[model samples]
Target: MLIDMSVTPLSADDRQRYARHLALAEIGEAGQQRLAASSALIIGAGGLGSPAALYLAAAGVGRIGLVDYDSVEASNLQRQVLFTHDDIGAGKAEVARARLLALNPRLAVDAHAVRLGPSNALDIFRRYDVVLDGTDRLAVRYLVNDACVLAGKPLVSCAIHRFEGQAMTYIPGRGPCYRCLHPLAGDALVPSCAEAGVLGVLPGVMGTLQATEAMKVLLGVGEPLLGRLLVYDALAMSFQQFSFQRRANCAVCGDNPTITRLEDDGEATMIEEWTPEELAQQLEGARAGSLLLVDVREPHEWAAGRVPGSVHIPLGTLAARATEIPPDRTPVFICAVGGRSMAACRYFAGGGRPAINLAGGVTGWSAVHGPLPRPEGCQS
Candidate 1:
């Protein structure tokens, strides 16, 4: 993933603007020149992209492409620093370009205000030296990985969920790919930041790490995070590293690669079928008022501001007492946050029962409705 170096030297103002970068022994004049030649395509203009794009632009990556069709919302401002309150309701890609150019007008910023699909991925990818995956969805993660593999480019991937963040760089033939780590994940649609709440500052940490890795890869300066998976727990203030290797049978990068291109027919399982906003919308509608609110948590948990009329059925006893559940009422399963409730929903839904997981569960519910009221005699 070597960028074509620019023969054109930095202007006087450019040198002044990047004096700190020029002062660095490792990333001085030569490294800055290489950065000015490199191109990076960031595939999501949200959490991870916000910081990464800013750093790349500030560092003077010649061409920065942002691909996203989503519009900015008030919710995005929690972690998407590139967008201010004024930028809300504007297209994320276009708005990101404006912010980046404002930071470094010399660099070229391409805004693809269109969805990243199989049809256009390879064509767009070929124009960049490296691809950064800022997207949170598993299916798209797979698509981006495969696209990078085919287009012969390196991918820096970072993801944040709840209090945890993970990052790894996938250099073609250099180390294990994303598929080598999680084979079955591509066939599923994991919850987005919208459904699963993230700590406001978590992506900021991970995205900066991604920017660091991207710079390292482009500059060939230090050891890149190619084979090592870095994990950060913000709550615990801890970072852990694990080693992984390329699989011999990886579907895209294997000896006899099976997947030549992206296919459209695969069924992706939704990690969260219902979000808090969606549930509220459904409740406001006609039919779901009779829906059963099943609280699948421990007694102590249920005593702590559980949904008022939810049927109490602890997860451990759910299987034994499955028959006791009223079949007529469509069950809206819930737990502390979302993990346990989604598991319960999947189990019940597998049996052909009408079951939906309360995304973010009670924590999500409490965010909207405040502290939920406990059952009449359950707690003071």
Candidate 2:
């Protein structure tokens, strides 16, 4: 995905603004012009997008597109540094576009305030030379990767969870795409930052790396993360690289690719859910005994705090200890957030038993009702 480096003469303001970039021999005048000519489409305006978008805009990526459907939630401020408290309730993409334009007025910022689905992914992707996938949603991650492959655009993909972050690059005919690494779309059961919690600086680090990779690919100078997974641990302050080859049977970028066109990647099996407010009312009523709250978080998380009357059953051992869950009572699954509990619901559904997920999990309950009451008892 070589950007057409038709040298665009930089204006006086551009040269003065990118004076530091002009000093680098690798970048100098030509690379700065290349960046000014290149375009990048960022597929999320959350934590990763915040830093990536800011850097690209400051570095003079002439054209930038932001695609995000979510609005600013108070939770986003912890990592999504693109917005301030004043920007809450506003569309993320729109806010990001405004911030980028403020950083570099020369940038052509396109704010697509919509979800990137299969129907429009290719169309939007065709307009950019490089794609940056900063989305935490697994299904959307795969979609972005596949769309880049199909649209013949290079993609810089990065994700952060807790204190750890991972980044990789995929170029058409260059190396493996994301699907080659995680082959199953159903693997969306993995916890996101919302469920697992992340260090505030984690995305800042990874997103900056993503921006760097996109610039490298755009400049066609340094080695992009192609064919390699770069993993960073903020806690340990360590970086590790794992090399992977393009899988021969990859459904998208393989020798005989099955995915001829972009289609929505089926998410994990949907399960019955109970909102925090709904579950709270149920617990206060006579139905409390008839419904059981099963906490599926780890032992450490269990010790932190738990809903009153909830029974602890760590997710890893749920299968082996299924008998402990009374069949007479309808089991309601819970975790730190809702992700692991959803997996628990899926497990029960597979065995022909009806189960309910605690939407947003214990965190949601705490958020709605202040804090969880002390657990009555711990059951394993």
* TM-score result, candidate 1: 0.72
Pairs that collide in candidate 2 are: none
Q: Which candidate number would show the highest TM-score if scored against the true structure? A: 2
> Residue by residue across 89-127, what tens digits does model 2's lDDT show?
899988999999988887899999987787799999999
Local error of candidate 2 at residue 198 (angstroms): 1.4
| Candidate 2: stretches off by over 4 Å | 2-7, 185-194, 267-334, 341-361, 365-380
Best by lDDT: 2
Q: Which ten residues in a row have the lowest lDDT in candidate 2?
A: 263-272
lDDT of 1 at 73: 76
lDDT to native, each model: 0.81, 0.85
| Cα lDDT over the full model 1 | 0.81
Q: Across residues 1-380, which tens digit of lDDT does each residue of candidate 1 receive?
A: 55786547888998998899999999998888888888999989989999999998988888999999878978789999999999988999999999999998888999999877777889999999889998865446877998998888999988888899999998988988888877643223232323457898998999999998988888888988887999999999999999998888988888878777765313223223566778878777886766777888778778877865688888777778878877777778788776666656656654657577786688878877788887777646
Each model's total of backbone clashes: 0, 0
lDDT of 2 at 17: 94
